[model samples]
Target: REMLVAEIEKRLPAWEKKTHLKCNGWQTKIMQNKWGSCNPAGKLWFNLHLAHTPIRCLDYVILHELLHLKVRHHNKDYIALLDKYMPFWQEVRKELNDFVLMPMK
Candidate 1:
């Protein structure tokens, strides 16, 4: 939990500075369905499980959410934006997606 918060604090601003996109706010919560989510309004919610993933995955999520501030959905424009920024986003996304956020019983 603390690690996740620290990573977000460290990464968010750096990415925001690079992308020139600011989010309204953000928080981490226990979520099973998604790694991260964002609204067109610029609020972001990240899954706490991210702490267990690789640091690069966390960076990917941060940039992914920030991009939402520009493009609302995962459409062509959004893909173009992500591709422009993180050329290896797809690999990181796949890694994060393959991670089990929770152990099923």
Candidate 2:
């Protein structure tokens, strides 16, 4: 948990610097089918499953959600922002989706 928070703190500033978007708070919790989510109010929730993925994958999820703070939908502007910030996001996303973890008991 602490490691996740530290990773988030390290990445948040750089994204905020690039996009001028700010998040007030963030936390991690178990999620069934999503990597991360963000609200317009600047709060973020990252899936605990992310800890199992590569660090780059985690960063991709973080940037993906932070961009959501700016654009509410996955439209052209959102895609453009992602392309601009993380050009390899699609690859990372594919890698994330392809990764499968065993069901927790």
Any idea what lDDT model 2 has? 0.86
| lDDT scores in order | 0.91, 0.86
Per-residue lDDT over 1-105 for candidate 1, one digit per residue giving the tens place of the 0 to 100 score: 897899899999999999999999999988878889997677999999888899999999999999989888899999998999999999999998999879433
Worst 10 residues of 2 by lDDT: 96-105
Model 1 scores worst on lDDT over the 10 consecutive residues at 96-105
Clash totals for all candidate models: 0, 0
TM-score for every candidate vs. truth? 0.94, 0.89
| Local lDDT at 16 for model 1 | 97
Alpha-carbon deviation at 58 in model 1, angstroms: 0.3
